[model samples]
Target: MTEQFGLFDARGLQPADAAAPPLCVRESRRARRLTLRVLPPHTLELVVPHGARAADVAAFVHRHRRWIERARREIASHYSLAQDRLPTRIALRAIDQSWLVRYESEPQAPPRVRVLGDELEVRTRDASNRGADAALRAWLCDQASYHLTPWVLREADLVGRRPSRVQVRLQRTRWGSCSSSGTLSLNAALMFLAPAVVRYLLIHELCHLISLNHSQRFWDAVERFEPNYEALDRQLTEAWADIPVWAHPDARRR
Candidate 1:
């Protein structure tokens, strides 16, 4: 279940500001502790562990009030939150490709994405942008898989470590992850980043095959593979601002 809170202070009673953003509190079975997520556009999500009291949730939000405010400011700087707009052109910098996006309204036809040379035609049944967004996300995943799979394999060869499998997804909080089973999961949004940053991420994950934890040995391995891993890692974190707002998961939620 989800609940929205009004203006409140650390004590959970006094109104901090009338313009304060409403906080969405959600209970999660998998959550171990109260966590805060500032989603794109300007939505604050508070994740409460099952059985957590309302007071704890309120206090958690209050303690992170400054963080929430700063995150909102950063997001506002990076994205135009006024409306959910579709992209007229999509650029994949990692692969150095761009495509013009065109849309067609077909009330009776199911939503579909068609590739025509350097253009993507999105045919949608829904009047809202939801259908088109969904179609584009699917297409993006396919494109990521097609390009990233081989890329991962090639990097694996260079690193002398082969993953059990490689999967590309539109992950919200992670750029890439490697499971104990040697499966590498990469975020589809990597396509929006530079090739060097993407390579650093791949090396970072592939190095996990050597050491899963961020131990000194892990960093050593990462550095061995990519000498400039530190700078690249920082660039990867900042690259979130470069991703088009349409590609954000929050766009679909909106």
Candidate 2:
């Protein structure tokens, strides 16, 4: 079931079934056309251009109803978050390291996570799966900060480019993005990708600081830094498949 929604209406769009996957409606100022995204967990998101009429949106969705349903079915049939469980032994190829994970349960204790040597340990008061997910994400963020920040700095220095700032976030669709102000935003999932892929991402974003788009100049600049960037870029496109289901707790039910 797909929950239907319009961009604007007096009482909003019609209600959907309780079992229906949520439908998100957003208006994008930069959008020149209507766009549909079938995100993880079979969620349907409709992006309408700014000032799109409600009647038009309704008709568009009606026309694409079958396509949306098929997409939802495909996603539900193929992608399973249960397969993404956090393992007791975790390998981070981007940083060339392996981790032995241990879970400790303590009543009335706050959830805590730490890394020692090649081992990662999580202490939790609540025995729920959600607690473990939170603990793991916290640890991943810590590791991403420790490893990715310096990697960016060293890579930037290689090209003699100094970004204004660098930030790490758990982004779903993109591995990294560079703002016009030279600020680099990296995905925490980069820790799961290969070293070459991670390096390519750093170089790719750094190149954006110079060219800002995928113009010929950008490729030329990227080549100056990484000769094998084209292959690495292609490899990066499939890197999301390497990220385990545990990495995305919110999409677990889907």
How accurate locally, in lDDT, is each candidate? 0.74, 0.71
> What does candidate 2 score on TM?
0.72
Clashing pairs in 1: none
lDDT of 1 at 205: 89
Q: Scored by Cα lDDT, where does model 2 land?
A: 0.71
Q: Under the 3 Å rule for N, CA and C atoms, how many clashes does model 1 have? A: 0
- Deviation of model 2 at 77, angstroms: 5.8
Q: Give the Å shift of residue 116 in candidate 1.
A: 0.7
Model 2 alpha-carbon drift over 4 Å, by segment: 1-65, 77-84, 252-254
**What lDDT score goes with residue 97 in model 2?**
90
Q: How many residue pairs clash in each candidate?
A: 0, 2
Best by lDDT: 1
Per-residue lDDT of candidate 2, residues 1-254 (tens digit): 01112236423332253334344565544569988876554445676776678888888888887876667556645555353455688788888898898887787777877788888887877444346666787678778988999999999988788899999977654578788788888888899888889999999888888876666897899999999987787677546567765665344532
Give the C-alpha miss distance for residue 157 in model 2, angstroms: 1.2
